[model samples]
Target: MSQNREMKLAAYLVGTGIHVASWRHPSAKPNTSIDIEALQHLAQTAERGKFDLAFIADSLAINPESHPQILNRFDPVVLITALSAVTRKIGVGATASTTYSEPYILARQFASVDHISGGRAAWNVVTTADATGETALNFSRDKHWEHDHRYERAEEFIDVVQGLWDSWEDDAFTYNKQTGQFFNPDKLHELNFKGKYFSVKGPLNIARSKQGQPVIIQAGASLPGQRLAARTAEVVFVHWDNIKEAKHHYKKLKSQLKDFGRNEDELHILHGISPIIGETEEAAIQKYNDLQNLIDPYEALKFVSGYMGNVDFSKYSLDTPAREIEFPHVNSIQSNFNEMKKIVEKEDLKVGDLYTRFFGAARRDGFIGTPVQIADELEKWFTEKAADGFMIQFPLLPNDLEDFVRLVIPILQERKLFRLDYEGNTLREHLNLKKPKNVFIQKTGASKSYSKI
Candidate 1:
C-alpha cells in the first residue's frame, strides 16, 4: 500500500464509557453512555467522520477487585445491534470470548447481527481473563485455564463456529411459499464438529450472513495470542506505547501470516490510541492536563499495578523513582510489563508520575496536539508502517468524539488519509477482504471450493 493510502482508522467505544477516568469530568455526560439516542448519535458521528468501524470491548466476568466506580453495564452485541439500526454505514465490531461461549450460539448471534446490520458486523475473539470473583458466574472452577490451553480451545472453538456458519449454502434459502418449502434440504450440511473442548451438531438455524461471516478481530499479544491472530484474525488490535515497539510487532505479525499460508494484506494491525486534539498544540496540552487533574492517584496506581501482572507497588513511596523498585513476574499481559519497564528506565519516572503516564499510555498510544500535529503523527505511523491504522479512543465521551470528527477528520480527508464516503456495505468489503467460502457447503457439493480469496 502507498504511504498516503496506508492507514485505516476506526473508533473504539466500549459500552457508554471510554477507558479513561477523566470521563467523569464536568463536561462529560456520564448518563449518556447507556442512552440509546446518545449511542446512535455517536455511531452517526463515526460514519460522518468516515471511520472504518465502531469497536467495543467485552469481558464475561467483571473484575470485582477493581473500583466499583469503573464498572458500567451494557451488553456489547446488543448495543451494537441497536446502533446498527440507527446508522446506515460504519462497521460494528464487538469482543466475544471463545472460552465462555458455545460455537453454534455465538455463530448465530453474530450472523444475526450481520443480517440486521446489512453485513456491517465484525467479531473480536478473546479468551476470558482471570479475575478472582468470576467463580460465581459459572466459570468451571476457581482456577483460570493455563494460557496455552485457553488459546488452544479458542482455536478449535473458532473452527467449529466457522463450520456451523457454512452449514447452509448461500442459495440454500428458497422462500418458496408456493412449493411449501422454506429452504432446500439438499443444500444444507451438518457440521458434526467434535473438538477437544466442544462438540457441536449440525447447521445454524439462520441463513449465511450477508458478509458470509462477520470479520474476525483478535487482540492477543502473547505467543499463543499472536499465533491465533495470525491464523484467524482479519483485524489485530495491538497496544504499544512506543513507535519502535509498535513497528516491531507489526513486522513480526505480518511475517507470521506467511507461515500460516495467509496473505499479509488479509490482516490489518491497528494500535490503540487516545487522542486529545485541539485547534492548537498548546490548547490540546491544556485540555489533556485538565483531564489529568481528575485522576485519582490511588485508583490509577491500582489499575496499573494489576495490568503489570498484579505486582504490588504499595511498598514503594509514591515519590520514589520507579527504577528503585524491583519488578516481579506478572503472568498476565507480559508484554505490558516489559513496555512499562522501558518507560520507567528511559524517562526516570517516579511512582506518582508513573500512574499519570500509565493512565495515558495504557489505554492506547496517547496523541495530544493540534489537528495538524495529530494528523502528522498519524501520517508518520501509517507511512512508516508502524501500524496499518489506529483504534482511536477518546478520554471524554461526546466532546472528544465531536472534536475529532469536526477537526482531525477534515485534515485527514484533505490529505486523502481517510475515506470521504464508504465504498461498500459489508465490513469485509470495506476492509478489502474477500468473503470467506462456506466449508460445509463445499463438502456437500453445493460449492466447488472452500478457499475464498
Candidate 2:
C-alpha cells in the first residue's frame, strides 16, 4: 500500500455475529456474546488480519423484543478496554451515548482507555435515540429527547468532552526530583465550560496519551448528524448498500469539511459491509440463504420497528403492502427510516418483504461472493470514491470473521489495497490522522515554550 493512501478496515464486533439470527447458526459458538475469551479472540483475529480497528455498537436499553446481540452483551466501552489488552495493533472502539452521559465523566473514561490501550481507543459518539422511550426510563426520565434537541445537546456535549481532553498540556507533568514542582501550573488549563446541555469545570485528572486523545468516531446520517460529523468526527461510519448512494453521501460529507475549515484528508468514511464469503459463488449464496431462513419474522419486524422509530408494524397483515400502511413520524435513525421509505415507495414491498429483503441479520446483497469476487467489488467501491474502506460486520462470529481474515484479507493485501502489516501503533497513526494539538497550547502559541522545558 502506498504511504499516500490505503483502505482502512474495521471489524464491527457483534457477540455471535452481526446477523440477527447469528446465534442460531449451526457453526456459531453458543454464549459467545458474553464470553470474555471469545471476545478477546475476535479482536485478536482482526489484529492478525491487520485490520485498522475493531468496533462494537451499543444501545442504552433492551427488552425481550430487542435484537439478540443487545440481550447478552458487556458494556461496550468496558469490553473494548478488555479487548485492547489482548490485541496490540487493532484500534478498539465502542459506542458511548452523549445523551445519557456527562461530558466530564465520559471524557475521563475514554482518556483513561487511551492511556490503557496506548492511545488505540476511539469513542463512537451517539445521542441515544430510543423511540420506544424505554431508554429514557432507564436514565430516570419519562421521555426521550426530541431529535433536534438531542443533536443540540450533542453539539454542546462534544465541545465539553474535547475541551476536557485538552485540560493538561503534553508537557504539563514534570517529575522534577530536584525541584518541588510536580506539574507546571502555567501549562495546566481548566475548562470552565458552560453550555446548554453541559457545564463542566475541569482540568481532567488524566493526561493526553500517545495519540493526544482517543479518536472521535461518529455514524449519524441525518442532516444534524452529518453536520456533527463534519465538525468533530475523525472517522465517520456509514451504511449504504449501493455505489450511487454511497458516492453521493461520500461527496456530500467531504464537501461539508470545508465549511468547518477541515480538509478532506482529515477524516475517513467507512461504509458498513457484512460479507458472506464462500469457496464459490454458489456456496456464498447458499450461506446467505441459510442465515436468512433462520431469521425469526417477529424479530425482523421488531428490528424494522426500531429503525422506523418504534412504529408498530404488527397491527398490519404481513402481506399488506408497506405503502398501504401509514408510516408515522420517526425519531430514531432518521437516515435508515428515510432509506427504508424510499425502498417501500420504489419497490412493491409488503410488510413481510422486509424480513427477507431489507431487515435481514446483515445487509449482504452487495457482498455475498467468493474471495476474489468480494475483493473486486470492494476495489470498485474504493476506486470509485464510494467509500474510503469498509466496516466489516461479520454475520457469524469466529466462523465468518475467520473466513474473511483467511480468505478475503490476503487478497486485499496482495492487491496493495490494505496493509500487509500494521505500520503504526496508535489508532490515530493507524488511520493516518494527525494528533490534535491542545486547544490552550494552540491558542496561546505555547508549544515552543513547552518544548524548551
Candidate 3:
C-alpha cells in the first residue's frame, strides 16, 4: 500500500443501491432514484470523501415487469449535470448508448455537462444490447444489428464524437468589447467527416473545456469493445470473478494500447466491486447473507436469465442439474456467459444453483469482509496489477456508503493507498491525466494568432 499509485475510485450510484434488494433493506429508501435529494446526498457523500468520480448508469429501454430498478430514473447525463451544480470537485459521469443515439446529440449532451461542471465530467460510451427495448421504442426490432456490427458502429460513433469535441481550439474565443470578432475563424476547424453510419459536417456549436475534453469512460469487454477502450477510453469498468482473471483482462486491455499509439497509463481499469462492510469481520459476512436471503428468488432468477442471453429458466425444474447447452447466438449481455458455461461443465449446478451463483457475481463482486479485511484484499489486487482501483458498489445506500467512506477510506488514506485530500480542481488533474490538445492546434504546429489583445 505504501508503494502504490494513488487510487482512482468512482462510486456507482445504481438505483437505491447496488444490492439487488437494497431498496427493501430497512436502512434503504426504495424510491431514492426518483428523489432528487437522495441522489444529491449520495453524490455529496462521495465528494466529501474525496472520491475521484461519482457514476450514474442508465438503460434506454425498460422492462418494469421484471427488472424494477432501472424502470424509472433520470437520464444519467441530466442527473449528473444537475448534481454538478451542487458538487464542486468530484467527477460525474453517466452511461449513454452510442448505438441508439446520434453522435452530434450525444456529443452535445456530454459537452454541455462538462462545461457546466468546470471539466469534471465523463461520458461512459456504451452500445445498447437490449433489442427488445429498442423495439418498444419503435426502432427496428427484428432488424437490430448483430453483436459485431453494433461494436463496429460504436467505434465509428465514438470517433465522430471525439472529432466534434475538437471543433474549437482552447483559445478560439476572443470576446473583446472593442473588437467585433467573436472567435478566430481559422481555429474553428470543421470536421467534414463522412462515414458508413453517419455524415456529420463541421465543428460543434460549443467551445472546448479547461481539460480540453471531457474524460471518456467505456465499459466494453468484447473484442471490438476492448479496442474502443484502448483507443479512446480514459477509464474502463471491468468485471472478473478472481484476481487471476482480472490480471489477464488487465494485461490484455493494456497490451492493445500499443496498436492505437496510446500510453498504457492513459486508461485506468477499475474492476466492479460491491463491498458489504460491517463493524466486524463476522458481521460483514452475515450482512451479505442477509441481503441474499432478502432477495426474492423469482426476481433473482428472472434477472440472471435475461443476463444470460434471455435463456428461459421458468420451465426448468429447480432440482434439475443445470447442463451446458450452447445457443447459436446470444442477443443479451455476454460478459459472464463463458464463466457460466465453465460452471455448468465443472460444477453441474442445479437450476436454482445456477441463478444464485449468477446473482452473486452480477450483484456483488470482489469479496465480503470487514473494513480492514476488505482493504487488505483491495491492496492485493492493486499491488498485483489486477486493477488500478475499484468502482465501488455499496449494498445499501446512506448507511453502507457512509460506513465505507468513514471506515475503509481512512484505512486506505492511512496506508497511502488513496488520496488524503483533493490535489486538483478538474477530474483530469485529479487523476493526473494530461489535458489533451485540440487536434487542429496539435497538428498545425502554429501559435495562436490573435487579431487583438
Best by TM-score: 2
Error of 2 at 257 (Å): 0.3
Ordered from best to worst lDDT, the candidate numbers read 2, 3, 1
Which pairs of residues clash in candidate 2, taking residues 3 or more apart in a chain or in different chains?
Answer: 20-361
The Cα error of candidate 1 at residue 395, in Å, is: 1.2
TM-scores for every candidate against the unseen true structure: 0.92, 0.96, 0.94
For model 3, residues 1-453, the per-residue Cα lDDT tens digits are: 345478788998876776667778776778888888888989999999899999998876666324566877898888999889889999999898877789999888888999999999999988767524453255555555677788888888887888888888888899877888899887787777778888888579999987888899988787878888898899999877679999999999999999988887889999888788878867887788777778776566666665565666666667767774443356545565666666677876777776556653233444677888888988889989999998987767777778889988999899888999898889999888999876655455674321100
Residue-by-residue lDDT tens digits, candidate 2, 200-232: 778799887889989999999999999999999
The most accurate candidate by lDDT is 2
Q: Put down candidate 1 lDDT per residue, 1-453, tens digits, no spaces.
A: 464354677787743335456555777666665677877888888888878899877665556335322366467889889989988889999888887788888999998999999999999998866434252257666566656888899999888888878878889999999999999887787777666687777678988988898999988888899999988999988878778988998999999999889998899999878888877877887777777777776667776665665556666678988887777655445566677887878887878777667654233233888888888988888878889899886767677888999998888888877777788888887788899877754445544422222
CA lDDT, every prediction?
A: 0.77, 0.85, 0.79
Q: How far in Å is the alpha carbon of 397 misplaced in model 2?
A: 0.5
